[model samples]
Structure formats: C-alpha cells, structure tokens
Target chain A: MALADARAICPDLATRPADLVREATTLAALRRWAGRYSPMVARDGPDGLMADITGVAHLFGGEAELRADLHARLARAGMAAQSAVAGTFGGAHALARHGGGIIPDGALADRLGPLPVAALRIDHDTAEALGRLGLRRIGDLIPRARAPLARRFGPGLVGRLDQALGYRPEPVAPEAEPPHFGVRLSLPDPVGLQSDVMAGLARLLERLCEKLGRHHAGARRLRLELDRVDHAGVQVEIGLAGAMRDPARIAALFEKGVEEVDAGFGIEAMRLVATVTEPLAPAQIGPARAAPQDGMDDLITRLGNRLGFETIQRLAPAESLIPERSFQVLAAAWSRAAPADRPGGPPRPVMIFPPEPVMAAPGHPPARFRWRRMALTTLRATGPERIAPEWWLDDPAWRSGLRDYWRIETREGPRLWLFHTPQAPAWSAQGVFA
Target chain B: MRCERAGSGALQLAPTRVHEAEGFGRHAFALFQSVCHDGPVVWVGPAHAPERLLLAGLPQGVGERLHIVRAGGVDLLWAVEEALRAAPVGLVVAELETALSLTAGRRLQLAAEAGGTTGLVLIRQGAGSNAAQTRWHCAPRPGAGADSTLHQWSLIKNKRGTLGDWTLHWDGTSAAFHLVAETGERRGPAPPPL
Candidate 1:
C-alpha cells in the first residue's frame, strides 16, 4: 500500500519496535570483520559502516574487487549492505545513499548534486521548509545565497550540506592497547613431552626478559598459553614478588605453571605473555660485595605458579591510626610505594589482631586478661597516647569516646598493647609484638 | 694401656686414644648464611575465619632486617612487583579473596622478572580464573599421631615438577613436613616422625 493512502486509512498505526541493542551488536561485529579489509573503520550510523581502503583496495585486486568481497561477506551474514568509496566520511555517506558506484575523490559534489536534500540528514521540518521554498534537491540549494540560507533555515543546514560534499574532516580513534609482553612459538609438529614444553618455555622466557631489559621494565605476572591439537588450550600464569627481568628467575616462576599445561592430544602452539609490567631502575653493584643468590625469589615463583597469586601477600604499614587499620596485606605483584617517616614515638607492634576486649583501668595495665584461652599479666606499662576520631567521617565506635593506647610488656615475654576509651570505660587488646 | 695390649695382641690396639674434641668456644659465629627453601604461604580454615600461616617460615634474625608492608586497596600484581624490587630481605606473601585482570597479572609477571625477587600469591580456590603457575587444591588431612592437635596436608598439583600426589603430615606444635605413604600402596618405608 502507498504510505499516504495507508496513513489516510489508519490514523493510529503502531510502528514495529526496533531492536537497537541487536543492531548495535551487529554493527560492532561488522566493524571487527571489516578490519580484514582495512584497519580504518568507523560506524556511519545505526545501519552503516565507513572503511578507508585507499591502499588496501589493491589487496583484493582493486576497488571493484573489494566492493564485491564486501557485498559477498555481508550477503553471507544475512545483511543487506550498500557501499561507496569517497575521499571523506561525509562524501562516502552521501555517495552510498545516492550514487550506486564508487565515486572518485573530488567528484562527490557532482555525484550528490541530484540527490534530495533529505540525504543531508537535515530535520524533517527543515526539509519540508526547503521543499516549500522550491529547494527540492541539493543542486537547487547549492546555488542559493549563503547568507539568506543561513538566516532562514539556520547554519546547521549549510553545515550538513558542506559536510556532505567533504568540506569537514572527521577522525576515527582506535582502541587502546593492553599492557603485556608476549612471545610465541609455532611448533613444526605437535609435541606431548613435558621436556619439550619446558624447553619451549625457556626459549620464550629468554626472549621476554630481553624485551623487558630493553624497555627498562620488569613483569610481576606472566602467562603461558598452550594451544593443543584438539582445538582446546591450556593457560598458566605465575606472579612474582617484584618487577624482575631475569630470565632464570622468570623461568623458575613458571616452572610449576608449565607442568600444569596439559598437552591434550599434543600441543601445537605456545605463547608467553607478561600481564603486569613496571619500570625497573638500574641496580647498584659494589666491587667488594658479592651478589647474593636469589633463592627466595625462585621459591616464590614456583609456589605462586602452583598455588596462585592471591594466596600470597606481604604486610605493609598503612596510614590509619586505628590499630587494625594501621597495617595492610598487599599482593606480591604490586610494587609498594616507599615508606614515609613515621611520627616520632615508641615502636608499634609488628603483628596486630582484631580488637579483643580487656578488663583494665584507663591509666593502669591489666592485672590479668583472657586471650585465646591464655591469661596474661602485664609486667610493664607505658603510654596514654590518646587518638581522636575524625568527626567528619561517619564512625559508630568513634561516637563512644576517644581511646588512650598503652604499650605494656607481659610476664610471658610477649608485649601486649591495649587501648581504653574514656566514654565506654572498657579496655581492648589492639596488637602484639613479634 | 700397655698391660691390656700384652694380654690380647689380636684385640687390643692400645684402645686408641679416644679423646673427643670440645666445642669451638673461642670462634665468633657468622651472622649470614644461605639456605635452600621451598613451599608456599598457607591460610587454613573457612573463608569467614581465615588464619594467615607462613609456610616457608622466617629466617633467623629476620625481625631485625625484614620489612612488612601493609598495602590496602592495592592490586595483587603491584604488591608482587613491590616485593620483587625490595630484594635480599624481600618476600611478599598475600592471601587475596579477590581476582585480578589480565593486564594486572601481566604487570606482575614483568615486575617479578625485573626485580629478581620471589613473589608468592595465595588466592582462594575458584575465586578467579585459573591462571597461576601451578594451581593447587589443598585440603585438611586427618591427624595421625600422639599430637592430637596436628593437621595433615596433601600436595594436589605441582605444575613446575612431577611432585606426584603426596600426603604431608604436619604437627602444629613443630610445623614440620612428613611424607605419608598412600593407604593402598605400601612400597616404601614409613616416614620417620619429627
């Protein structure tokens, strides 16, 4: 049925709902597939994609060959696509919408001249106004006075018209690259022996370390991927205590991980990648002092490869004043920021447990307190360093009162630290000395 | 000594001066020494109540030289890198319940290589993708000895080497590794108690 007759017959006909998300996903998939033809691709709109194939066109033989390939691929993917090549995004959009064949770089205006003004993507109201002013096509409006056109229809109309003829430049930004160092080995034949895999890994690690050395960088995390002949793959990652570029050290770390890669039906390919990298500064070498053997690092890498990275951690001092909040356990892979000078005072406990209640006076040490089923008596007492809570932050316990901390040496030779709040009149064991 | 040799010439070789050497009392003891150590940091018990246990243990006089960093909100990869850069006295052991991204893991690998220090990461099983070197599954083993307060452990997987499946009997009081033979197979002598 004709659109006008159908609209006249039915005053309120509901339009079919458009699946926007599906269309967007399809467009993204198309963009990825389009990369096979050219790296420079941009989404023209909901249903279009613009690909720059200047030098890439010859790869498929010529522009005609490239267009035919695009049509065949889109047809196979069940999409109805129309493509045109021009010097600019605007020209391409216009030529694709109007001109059927590919137009040379400078001939966009001539080809687009006969197309309706709607091809400029102007608003329906503006197009209707142009139609009423006897401006039915782009050819009719191109010769009109610029001042009158801008004053009557707004500058956007002229801007869109100029953009269609390649007067404006548009830039397409690419995706960000992931931070990783990788090396690959393509085996001549699938190998199932563990020794072969290890040999391959050793070679890859050497290459990766060389890359790290050149970049003045070290990796904290490394991954080895084994692509098997059965279409499945195995991947292993090893984390380190610090950034390091030593091939032996890195290989040691992956020792356990390499064993985990199942050569299911034999492995055909291998890839080594460093997932985390940090800047490495030059080390100081003294003539008199011999370099120490790094056995602990090798052990850590082997353990980390098998057990995983999160299970390992190192305790670092935190800035918080609260006893439990004053220290933190960080992962081995992350580099620690340099420690700042602590405020002058007696030493803090090396190990701290969660707050445990104690029975003691505010100023005196507890005569006897129960902890983990053991009764402890204080032999020495010191400190009443009162710490006030930041009122600006919401804290339920801070509402009780300020805490006066005491560093006390216990009779068992273990130093016990406790704190008492004035408002609550109760004591709590905060931490212990190593 | 001369009389005994005369009585039996075949038996008595003058009872060879059996003098035992005394301890070295005058020599000063050296402070530094190197030792080969392996194993990981372990935390036993349920996730709701975690117990941070150091498996490799601390070296003697470590209290004087060791540095502990309490880094909250920092990712595991960066923590490992930091520990590697701080070598000799460097060792970073963490128990993380969270997962890290691929990029974070790569950064950690690079840092470990550069620092020439060991990075030990202990993550809860199944918390994230299995990307670690070995990927072990540890479970509590039944105690077997006079010390009723001991826990046994099993080495589920060793990715680096063929450490085949083996049971380790641990005494909580002593914290030692004792190899336990599999129940069905009796091919080897019993491991001596520590």
Candidate 2:
C-alpha cells in the first residue's frame, strides 16, 4: 500500500513513480500487434489478452501452435503473457489464471470442478461468506439446490458458477481497431514551398487511392495535415457530393485551402487521410453517363469547398398553399428531389423579405403608398389574391389573420409584390417580381 | 454589358472614386443581366450584403439563373477564383473590397483561361495597372423616375490599346441597349454594357 512501510521492511528497496498514461499507450499498441493472431483481440482487465480464434486456428496450424507463437513474440518484445482457449469466456478466464491449456468442448465443468470457489472471480466478502457455509471448492456448490443457493449467496454467486460451467453465454467484446484510409510522407529535409507541399500531398493521395482501390471504397471527406518543424500543424478538409478518387481533381479542390496554410519554418511531414468513406461498386463507364457525372461531381465539390458545404442548397417544393411553407431548402449534395411545377396559378415572387409596413391610401387598391424609407408610387395594380391562414397549423407568422396580395409596378421602374392584412391599417412589401 | 465571342476575355468593372456610394453591389445585377450567358451566374459577396435584392431590377428569367455564394469579406477573392476554375457557370460576379495585388489579378486571369469562365469583380475602390482586358468606370444616370436607363461608362484600359468614353441607354420594356453618342452619331441597340 504505502512505499514507506514497504521500505521499512527492506531498507534498500527501490521504487519509481507510476506512469499510467504511458502504460495505457503501450497496452493499446500491444492490442494492435495482437491483431496479427486474430482480428478479434481484446485487453482482458489491466494485464491480460483475449483473442478469439474460432475458425482461424487452422491458419496457424492449430490453437496451441498460435498460442506458442504469440507467447514467443511477446517475450521478445519484453512482455510475459499467459493465454488459454475454452468453450466459454469465464472458463477460459478461470483456467488461464489457474491451469492453462486448451480445454475440449463440454469438459469445462469436469476440469474446473476441483478448483477453489474463489476462482469464480467473486470478491473477498463473498468468498469468506461461502467459506462460512462450508463450501470450499467449486465442486462443493455443484450438487446444491440453485434456488436455495441463490437465496443465501445472491444471484451473482450462482451466475458466475453457471458461466464457468458453460451454462450461460458471456461473450467478450474486443476493443476495435481504428479504421483509417490514411497515407503519410516524411521528407529528408524540411520544405516550406507550396509546390513541395503539393508534391508530398500528391504522393500521399496516390498511396491512399491505392489502399481505397483494394477495399473498393471512395472518400467523401478528405483531411490534409501538414506538420511543421515549429510544432504548428495546419489541417484542411474538403467534402464531396459523391465518392471520388481522382487525384488531380481532389488536389485541385484543395488548392485554395492549401495556399492559406502557414508553413512556419518548414514542414517536415504530410499526411492525407480519407476520414469519411463509402463503399463504391466497380462499374463500367457507359458512354452517355460518365462525362456528365464526372463534371457534375467536380462542380459540386468545388462549390462546396469554396462557399461551404451547407451553403449550397437545393429547393424542393412542399405540399402547402402557404407561401413560405411551399418550399424547403435541402443540401445540394445530398438531395436528388426536384420541386414539382404547379400550373394555372399566379407566379410566386422571386424574393421574399420581412414585412416592411407601408401607409396605404384608404381605397380599393391604394394608388400610392409610403414604405417608410421610400414613397412608392403605383403605376398599375393587378390582384386581390387572398391567402388564408391554415387553422389546423399553429404558425407564429400567420397570427396576423389573413392577407390580400397584389402585384404592382411602381413608377420608379421596379415591379413589387405587396400584401395587405385587414387587421392593420397598412400594406407590407413581401416579394419582388424583378 | 453584352456577351462578345471574340478576342475579348473576362473584364473587371469598378466604380470610379467619386461614385463609390453603394457601388460594390448596387449595379452587380445590372451588369450581370447585360452580358450573362446561358448558364447560371454565381454572385459572391460579404455575408452581410443584401444578395436577394440583386435580381430585382433585371428581367423575369434572369432571377432564376443566379446562384448566390456568401463568403467572408476577406475570402471573397478566393471564392471567386475557385468558382471560375469550376467552369460549369459562364459568369462569376464577385463583390469585394478593391485591395487586390498584381499576383492575385494574374492568377484570376490564368484560372479564367483554363476554365473559359468570365470574371467580373465589382469593387468600390480603384486600383492601378489591371490585368483585365477592359476596365470600365461606371456611374448610373437614372431617368429621374422613369425606366429610360442611362449609364455613363469610361473605358480606362483596353487590351488593343485604344481608350474611349460613352453614355448608353436601355429600353426597359424592350430589354435592349442603345448607344447615346456624344455627337449624335451612334444609334440602335447597343453592345452589352457589362
């Protein structure tokens, strides 16, 4: 517990401060190396390793041979490891700490029946309580009634025994490895030129595309990371509408962003990662479709990076008679739905703004009105098209009751779309027919 | 403001120093309507700029052919350059502060050559030695309250090395431009006045 008390027993004992972060990093690295044995490898508690080798045992000759190889490799890496294989997770865990080997199917109960009940992984209080009941070995609790045993010792005691005896399923969840479509390049000497950065980025893209080709994948979001010697790293990202792999097009899209990167001192290395990817099927480029698809994808990608991915939006019509509710904005890259054209109705305004009140001369269609900042003189008036609020819908903007829309051409040579609400003694400019 | 398929390239139009009042975006839509091609035109300006009203003074179909991109005030130039390189659209109208370096102008010219996209930079401030084929200083002469559009334009820089100045008028109902010669010599529908 305390270093001072331990040193009192042996005055010359040595000690060092614990580095938990470093230990955790080393464990994670060990987990990656263990993936060579099987894809499903997990860290068991703080010091153990768990690898699932179901149908993969044949790849390394057999289960015992794979375990031997793993132990030898770990020993060479300065780590002493212990492992076991069994039909159940609890059986393997218990046997690995007590007696290590491959236990055949349906033989876990017989092999583990003689071990102490402590090997069931119960705590000290439960073990002492079990000892008070004169149950010293795992076999001592096997022939007892389950309901009575559960009532006295609790369900956890019974559950652990069932799991160790292969009666319950306790599947081990392995720590998953990070999925990355990334490539890196390190220069012999640090270079700060944009052309050099471009060259390194081009190399990284080639390697990344090769890896993507092997996996039949395409990147939707790419990250360019440039690490400078002065410890300042610049990262830029580009998004695409569809899957892309063309190196020239991808590099061209990053031109503006790359120029803005501040390579303080010099950049030593560059990394390109396809952070977001999707499965792309191999398809033959038919004559009519290839050119249009490529061109469209290029255009959308450039616009998305230049402005913003969210700023480029497509308008889709909705099933509503209300002016504002008649359309919705969808992301241009994500939407394929086009607005359906409605015929035989007056054209909607090209632009709509917040209602700016204008003083209307009290008459059936005011001849001239003052819109606060400017006095608009009406040259012609066309409509009394009435739009009523949807009663079933609770909209805050529609609380003004009802509106009558009119298309008028002002004497100032501008076409205007104006609306009048019966509740207020004024008219408001809604849209422009410009 | 009309499209010319000849030795001409992308032209940069800026309002003179005396006419900088609301000049950056005041006439962007006007110049855009005069020379736009068949494809959509991208209008790049500050985030605070009133972009929706830029189409109010143009014809009916011109409003539908526009795609607006809101950029940060400083990144407006880069956005315009990127749009030009995309080559899908024919015209790129960018409203930005006029503080461009010579290299920035040359880069825009090179990008336009690669994509064949026309670049129109609308700025309130003036600069010297432009890479644009033609530089025009524009000031609007509204017809009091009528639709008879009159604009005085000075040709500051011409690629062929010739310079001139003129005033042009447009018929609103007919959507046609008429050159108003100083000595009453030129007449009829004028060339585009972008």
Model 1 CAPRI quality: incorrect
Q: What DockQ would candidate 1 receive versus the native complex? A: 0.03
Largest lDDT belongs to which candidate?
2
True contacts kept of each: 0.02, 0.08
- State the lDDT of candidate 1 residue by residue for A177-200, as single tens digits: 333589999999999998898899
Model 2, residue A51: displacement in angstroms?
2.6
Interface RMSD of 2: 5.9
lDDT of 2 by residue, A228-270 (tens): 9987888989998788887877888788788999999999988
> By DockQ, who's the top model here?
2
* Candidate with best TM-score: 2
